[model samples]
Target: MTSLSPAPLISLTWTDHVTGTEGYLVVDRLVRGVSSGGLRMREGCSLAEVAGLARGMSMKEALHFDADNPGARYIPLGGAKGGIDCDPRAPGAYGVLVRFLRAMRPYVEHVWTTGEDLGLSQDLVDRAATEAGLVSTVQAAYPLLDDETGARRRLAEAFAVTVDGIGLDELVGGCGVAESALAAMDRAGVPHGGARVSLQGFGTMGGATARFLSRAGLTVVAVADVEGTIGNPAGLDVEALLAARDAHGTVDRGALRHGDRELPADAWLAADAEVLVPAAVSYAVNTVNQAAIKARWVVEAANMPVLPEAESLLAGRGVTVLPDVVVNSGTNAWWWWTLFGDIGPDAEEAFAHTRRSMRALTDRVLERAAADGCTPRTAAHALVADRLPVMAERFGWYR
Candidate 1:
């Protein structure tokens, strides 16, 4: 892990009187006078977390755009994230969301274009935008229909294209997690069907990755949700677990029939698996449990999933880790397509392009790491950061 670096460019906080809650907006960097990100509202969300996420988002932009294609017009927006603390299910959540958006009108209009995250849903974003007089047409929350299946059905009726399945693959970041993980396994000489995987945080990101990895023939030996971890020496049934997941992406422990043993909350770390994915939250694989992780690869499917010291420890122990910026980038690619693609007739081409872009970049990072004798995280940091000085020089933004 590297030493600490420069702090964020701006950090703003305010209290929304309507919700009686605090809101934080952290701008990690400003590229070309713009920074765009989501407005998440998970319980216990904090300013530091928002800043860290903004930093990650910034790195994602750095890694995605470069000299060859440049794509300067739309490729890299500055990195920022906004968040609030409040129960999304509260009866007055809409009022709180409206007030929160209104309070941040200046930032939203001039600094960042924010979307939904965590507890912030599509309906809430739309309602808030209308009430706050901000344009609601562009806010993004996946499967916006609450019922993805229904949305697909409606799309099929309106458009002549084929829309298949519930289409969680529409969730770009989750798809990226599986793609990067599989690519990492392939680099390690683990064949497509040969790797065994374990995952923590069986929510949207984790669950989507599990479905993808399992479909691609990986053995998911252990998975843990908020309550506890479950394991089986042989692979667990990904289909069953997905079917059992709650609306919030949790799988009830009571629904398990195949997992041979139910372990403590942290036992997922000790699973006899080849790949470990911490998809739940930050500080999950830290000093306390870092020593116990047995996986050959730790793919961070969540932003800021590993602390610096733990990442260093894992590297010292010869466990390779594909950083979150690489493994958790599918959604970023998806968003680019969503905003820019001409889905009328070239939709298939658009998706194909997204997948290829995600894979090519991930492969580039992995290869560079192999040659440089550093962790993927380190290699990715250098590879992406090297571009900034040039960008700053040309853009005249950094002093």
Candidate 2:
């Protein structure tokens, strides 16, 4: 059974009255009357982009389903996504966000549960949601919880968790990404000790990924932020750079050491590294820039960071592109895992669950790719194809 339909279940567009900015919400699928995804704010976000992201969310949700494991409590929701076409750093951006939330509040209260994505943060989203008079971003899912109060408390407690000054919510996704990369290395027989990585975008996902991978013995040779690219052939200090980042993930240039060399922004595409992570904007690695990449693996830490044509080109050159639907799904899954009682509100438990789940999924995707002689993304789609039918049969598609 195919997981994708010709079009989304529902799509809405809103225009902010004050700033004339545009916002979009695409509900690609619905299970038990609700869907899950993130709300991203950026200058050029469009309906088409949000639709693609929503569809990806659906696949991501289905890929994590272990229907055989009856003990699992975290049932994957349907996929959805929200996007706003306005720069988050622009003047009156906050006001625009509040208005967008207000306009999208009905969907939030009834069908779609959202959090930070791309150019926004959870704190910012939560604050704006409150200003929009909403109960919570995930209020739509309250009906699915057996103990709503306890679930809310558990989620709140989990969000309060901090390991070495970083929030657990922020670290879980990165943990998943790092584990996936490690799984790929294991499949290829590459030692982690001297494996090099270059990352684009040092925000929540990128910064957290750098931390986990660096701690796991991978040398982060270059990291790109809004300012530019910072490189150190001998490997940069991951912790120091992470500490110097802003909420939007831009690193403070003042924190660079003498040995650190500044390179052009897109130079990260060509860094001498074993792994390249595009954790920033969509279509970051397009056909033109894909030629510059020399990494063995392109680990997608962001949604649709590598264009399809670029991925095909990379594949022709023998580069493996780990699909984002599987690679960067930890953060979304972690929220449900904690809220639905599949896992507790502790850092170790969260990390353990994310690692096990992501590694297994990665291995399965890689193995499927090998067996079918297809790309990892196609293998992931094949996996989703098997599970989405079961979810629909059990939950009644639109529920």
Best by TM-score: 2
Which pairs clash (backbone N, Cα, C closer than 3 Å) in model 1?
Answer: 172-330, 172-331, 173-331
Count clashing pairs, candidate 1: 3
lDDT of 1 by residue, 329-381 (tens): 66654554444332222335534655577678788998888899888988888
**Candidate 1: worst-modelled 10 consecutive residues by lDDT:** 136-145
Tens digits of lDDT, candidate 2, 148-209: 99999999999999999999999999999999999999999999999999999899999999
Q: Which stretches of candidate 2 lie over 4 Å from their true place?
A: none
Prediction-by-prediction clash tally: 3, 0
| Residue 374 lDDT, candidate 2, scale 0-100 | 100
RMSD each, Å: 5.7, 0.9
- Give the TM-score comparing model 2 with the true structure, all chains together: 0.99
